[model samples]
Target chain A: MERILAILVKDRSGVLTRVSGLFSRRGYNIQNIAVGRTVEPGVSRMTVTVDADPLTVEQIVKQLNKLIDVLKVSDLTDEPAVERELILVKVKAEPGRRSEIQQMADTFRAKIIDLSPDSMIIELTGSEQKLQAFLTMMQEFGIKEIACTGKISLLRGSKVTCDMKI
Target chain B: MRLTGAQMVLACLEAENVEVIFGFPGGAVLTLYDEIYKKGFKHILARHEQGAAHAADGYARASGKPGVVIATSGPGATNIVTGIATAYMDSVPLIAITGQVATPLIGSDAFQEADITGITLPITKNNYLVKDINELPFILKEAFHVANTGRKGPVLIDLPKDLQAQEGEFYYPETVEISSYKPVYEGHAGQIAKAADAIKKARRPLLYAGGGVISSGAHEELLQLSKMMSIPATLTMNGLGGVPYDYEYFLGMPGMHGTYAANNAINESDLLIAVGVRFDDRVTGKLEDFAPRAEIIHIDIDPAEIGKNISVQIPIVGDCKLVLKELLRRLQPVEKTNAKKWCANVLEWKTSKPLHYSQEPGDYLKPQFVIEEFYRLTEGNAIVATDVGQHQMWAVQYYRSQKPRTLISSGGLGTMGFGLPAAIGAQVAFPEKQVICFAGDGSFQMNSQELATAVHYNIPVKIAIINNKYLGMVRQWQELFYGSRYAHTSLDGSPDFVKLAEAYGAKGLRVAKAEETAATIKKALEIPGPVVIDFQVDPEENVLPMVPPGTSIVEMIGGE
Candidate 1:
């Protein structure tokens, strides 16, 4: 079981360490972490997704929120949220097959960032489900390399995290 | 008045209160050298750029600030790498400035060009290559900022030859905006409270301290908390002096070569409070058995350090300074002088062994006596750097570091060929303070090219070369348990150290008598420039209280 969490923390050295430390100590596999500044002064927003059951996620959220540098923390897995990930895929394509791969990429809505004589680099952005679908469709073109930014997320509704049910 | 990048080098240094520098000049950096002469600052010339870096490192550790070294491009720039890497591993703050080939020559691999910034990137906490003249001031400011802040480490600045020669106006800034560089200074209160509650409840509790306590200036806080809770203490190699060495509850060192009582105490403890230390392998022998029964309370400045090598029951991640202060605050109402019965047992252990070892007369020289005399002659005031080998072990075993930052060595890297140059940097960093290099005969040969650097700078550093006529440490291993099959351990064919020192224009001494040891060391320090004393003794002598490789704390040999 995997869950997403939103946390507001004061931007400081070792806060990420403390949060990640909590999960690791509990044997939780953290899949991704994205940190950025929030609208509130001195506050930074973080969305961390981890491969853990609801109880472990709840424990992590409770522990992270208790940190002096942490302003608030919540499990956003059940909430309406917009989640996205960016990926770069480089494929070893022959000159004869490059145009065919380009046509296939157009269907998946990925853009061609660079092209060499035998390689075509493509960039894609979407939810995990969408990425899986694109990867499955592009497998026919022979995927050679892949690198992804994990994920970054934001709440979908106008309601801030503080207004949601704790 | 506005100045050029070259001129600003000396100006910013002077502004930062840098009184002297240790470095070698070269062609690509001729402009930097030329600008150096424009103003009057003491610059010690070294034969090799490596010597300059060591001297700078030495000076920094002695003075408790960043040591500065300068070098030219390509070979000259690359030579100081060992010294920089040594500083990086030991967590010594040093500012290394190198001259690069012009910006255009970069990536083209022109004459005297090397990507020093790239080569040094991973080793340095932060590094910069000034391609634009306008960025020089900002770059320099950030270089110092990054060097001194958060876990203090070395920072390098590679100045392109064109940038050094360019006459663009320099405007040194007073500030920098690094949103990502902020370090957490406050400890989590809940964790502290929980740890304290655990400490108060623990009957067989242990408090372990490390170098981070000294770095964070939390020695007083540690003392206060320990005294308040009446906790027995153990110190890692870097953690010595976090509290008094003579305290009844103190376990001096706790692994491999740690005191018998300390290791035994750890094995028996029910709860352990580990603070300001990463459970390094040297401290925790065979992690599976280390503190097997004890529930661990780990307080660390870097959260990554907690449970890195050992599991933690209660984890507190915060700056040592901040966490210690919070602990002291919370334990304010508790009594400070309380004691328990375990304290009596530990005091007995401290006195019983105290590193008991003896030298049987043999062909190889004894390093222990040389270190003992080095400490005596200097009155424990000189800053010492050591190259890894038998001599390094002797230095640690025989000498006492009464204060923090007084002893600088390659703890993590265990790097050989570290002594001579690091001592030079130490001398240059603090010209007023004496620096000494405890080098093995074999290890010294590796970096002895810097002897020329010593003469050029005329730094009054003393080098005590323990000549055992063999790669003594390795030979000791071969002698002890390797069926006495000596391979390439013989160092007799190496360069004659006395002649080598004379060639570099420094005083050299070769003494075999124990009676002449103390007086000879005194004279070496009294003499001008750098001096190398080759102390020849029992080549067959071995460091005892030996914990054979991969063995646990319980398995100690030579105690019989």
Candidate 2:
């Protein structure tokens, strides 16, 4: 099962290495990870997607909580939440196929962020499913280069995760 | 008052009420040593950095306080790596202070500079590299707090020379406020209730205890719970001293090298209350087959340890002492007849396959006999530290510990050269109590230099070297698994341990005959200074009740 874990950790040097080192050392398969500054000044939030069984996932959470810098860990997989991933894909496009590519981008609400004579870069931000579908469609035109920002997520409603008393 | 970083270090240590420090002086740590001398904190200078770390660890284990050790950078810092890892593996509370190069020269690889924090990341519970002088006091305070609190382990603080020399305002915090590090002490009522109900209903129940029972000072609670429900108890290697060895309900140690009764009981029990045990591979021969019929109730302070090794039926995440107390309070007192049948069966196994070795008036001394004599001579009142090897297992099997915190050994890392330094620390911690180190010939040589430290301090720690003339444990494994090839296991060029002891200004005795074992031990014990007694034992003897690798605990080969 694929599980998403939101981890809040102190903003200190080498903390990222420490957290990632733990995952690698324990043989936990990290599918994707996105790290960014949190609302607090000296804290960072990391969203990690891992493929493991329920027991293994629980072990990972507990291990993450053991790290001194890791402030909070939550399994967002079962929670009602909104998740998004961004991708910038450069697709080979000739003059004749450009129109079709533009129409497809428009349908997916994606934007042509960059363009060249033989290729066009399309930027898309959406749920992982939407991003995967758009990538599959672009693969038809030969994706020359690709980059992705791993999924980041937020819970729905007023279920605040950051403001919980530490 | 303005103070140097070194002064702040001492101030924070004093604030934490640290009475003694085990450390060695080096160029990088000169300023800190100067401050230590000026402030007059009792410091024992170890012969090696590793000895310093192990000594501190032994002090902590004996006194239930965080052990303190200081070392210089580069080689000095790296030397303590083994000790740090040993302490980390055993969950011994230790605070290691290392002096680093000047801040500006940190990344440049200046003289005597090593990234001590980076080197110790995996081994330490937590570590800090002090970059600013102002953070010195807080870092020191936090180091001790992190070391001594919840699932205690070693913590390191790397102090740069420049920072140690720089003056700063030092303020030791009255209380640490680490938001993420609040350890859960009290067990959840719901989990405690479930545990209690399981105990109430269990017919064939066994209590599997570990070092956490000793670390949390919960021996009394464990005894009460076992007595209340008549549950036979078994201990892990680290858990040996938690319950008195001769306790009626105690089933002895379990897993590899475990007694037949303990292993058989674990296999047959329906309910296993595993407290503070990590279910190590040595303790669980084959995980899939370990305690096959048992529904495990794992009570541990670290949530990470609850289900990491085995599938726990009931998990209580809290301190062992607190959880055991809660379980005791919530549990209903049952009649002794409840587990009478099960106890009878366990006792039968115990009496039928009791631990035994040949004593047919041999020429050579038997290590087991030496340990037995030591136990008899000490009357089970001494603190026994041991190095990792056959002697370690024999010490655990033969020498009975009557109280908690008395049997200190390097269980997790199985580091050699731990016994002497650890005994030194134990002696320093309790000067009136007798401290003895049971070391193997291969193990004693690893840090035999510590004899000098003991002699200089007049620590009076007795060291019994089981001189088997081989790396006994590995030789046994080779003998069993590799057709007795004995590759690189022989200590052919070992030093004369007695001469080495005398060279260090300590008393030394050599016992070659079996009949002289008791008298030799008596003489060594009567010595006022540090004493090393070398007992030449059978070289080929192996630890019995052996569960081979990848085999089930029930499949034992040797004992009886």
Candidate 3:
């Protein structure tokens, strides 16, 4: 099963290394991860997706919480949360296939971010499933290059993950 | 007052009430050493960085204070890696300060430059690279705080050369406020109630105590709990002193080289109250077969350790002292009449296949006999440290440690060179107490250079080298599993340890015969300074009552 963990950690040097090192050392496979500064100063939030069983995922969260730099760890996998992933993909565009690709992008509500003589860059921001579907559809048009900002998530309502007192 | 970073380090140490530091000086830490010299804290110069680190660990284990060690950059920092890992494995509280190259030259490959924090990240509980001079005091405080609290492991502080020389305001915090690093000292009430209920209902309950009982000073609580419940208790190597060996409820250590009674009792237990013990492979020979009929309740300070190896039925995450006290408080004293049958059965097993060795007249000295003589002479009052090997097993088997913190050995890491330096540190911590190192010939040579350090400091430590002329443990393994092919386990050419001790200005003795063992040990004890005794025992002797690897604990051999 895939589990989503939201971790808030002290913004210090080598913290990322520590987290990643722990993942590798413990053999936890990280599917995707996104890290950014949180509202609290000197604190950063990381949303990591890992493929593991509930027992292993619980162990992972417990181990993460053990790190001194890590403040709080929440398993948001089963929570009511809004998850998003942003992807920019450059697709090959011939004179005839340009309208076809634009029509496909329009159906997915993606916008054209950049254009060149031979390629068109489409930008899409949505849930992981929608992005995966869009990428699958664009594969026939020849995906020249693709870049993705891995999944970042938040609770649906007023349940803030980082509001806990340290 | 404003002070240099080095001065702030000294101030932090003094504020922490650190009486002595084990260290080796180098170019990167010259300023810190100068400050230490000026401030005049007792510092013992170790021959090697590893020796210094192990000594610090020994001091911490023996004195219940965080041991401190200092070293220079690059090689010096790397040399302490084994010591740091050893402490980490055993959960010893240690503060290791290593010098780094100048801040500007940190990544420029300058002389003696090493990314020590990066190198030690996996081994240390926490570490810091102090780039800013002003953060030195806070970093030092945090280092001590992290090292001494919770699970208690080694913490490192990398002091760059330039930062040590830079000026900073010296304000030592009276209290460290690490919000995320709080350890749960109190067990949950519901969990404690559940454990007590299980204990009450259990017909064959066993208390499996580990190092945490000793580390938390919960020996009295453990004894009280055992007596109140009339529960039989078995100890791990680290938990040796948690209950006196003479205690009726006490079973000997349980594991690979454990007693037949302890192993059989564990095999037949119904409720296992495991406290502060991580079920290491040596303890549980075959995980599936271990305590098969028992419902296990694990109490540990580290939550990750619970259910890590064996499936724990009820997990309590708290300090052993606190949890045991709570359990004792919550439960009513039970009648021991119901447990009388179980105790009688355990006693039958104990007496049926007791730990025994034969020593005929005009025979060579047996290592077990030597340990027994030492125990009889010292009355089990000395702090005994052992290097990893058969001698260590013998020491654990024969020497009955009656007090907490009296037996300090490298149980987790099993480092060969740990005993001598650790003894030096223990002696330094408690100058009035007798400190003895039960070392093997193969293990003694690893850090034998520390003999000079002991002599120089006038540490009255005694080294009892069990000279079997082979890596006895490995030889035993080879003999059992590999058709007696000794391979490279033979120590054919080793130093003359007695002469070596004499060369370092210490008393030396050699006992080649069984009759001479008692007199030699007494003679060595009478020496006012460090003494080394070489006991040339039979090389073929092996630790008996062995559970062949991967077998159940009940499947022990050589007991009869």
Best by DockQ: 2
Worst 10 residues of 1 chain B by lDDT: B332-341
Q: Candidate 3, what DockQ?
A: 0.70
| lDDT (10s digit) by residue, model 3, range B319-424 | 9999999999987887766577888898888888889998888877899999999999998899999999999999999998888898989999899999999999
- What's candidate 1's DockQ score? 0.08
TM-score of chain A of each: 0.86, 0.96, 0.96
Q: Please report how far candidate 3 places residue A110 from its true position, in Å.
A: 2.5
lDDT of 1 by residue, B69-130 (tens): 99999999899888888777666778999998888778897888887876775567767778
- Identify the leading candidate in terms of TM-score: 3
**Model 2 lDDT tens row, B1-560:** 79999999888888888999999999889999999989888999999999999999999989989899999999999999999999999999999999999888889979888888888888899999998898888888888888988999999999988888899987778889999999999999998999999888888999999999999999999888888888889999889878899998887889899999999999999999999999999999999999999889999999999889998999999999999988988877777565899999999999999988876686567789899999999999999999999999999999998789999999999999999999999988999999999999999999999999998999999999999999999999999999999999999999998898889999989998888888888888998999999899989988998999989999998856
Tens digits of per-residue lDDT, candidate 3, A21-139, equal 88988999999989999878899999999999988987898889889999999999899999999999999998789999999999999999888888999999999889999999999
Candidate 3 chain B: 10-residue stretch with minimal lDDT: B331-340
Model 1, range A10-123, lDDT digits (tens) per residue?
Answer: 775556766676677557788898888877666777888888766556556654543445667778888898889998888878889888888878887999999988888899
Candidate rank order under DockQ = 2, 3, 1
Candidate 1 residue-pair clash tally: 20
How close is every model to the real structure, measured as TM-score?
0.79, 0.96, 0.97
Global CA lDDT computed for model 3:
0.92
How much is the lDDT of residue B129 in candidate 3? 94
Give candidate 2 regions above 4 Å deviation.
A91-104, A116-120, A133-144
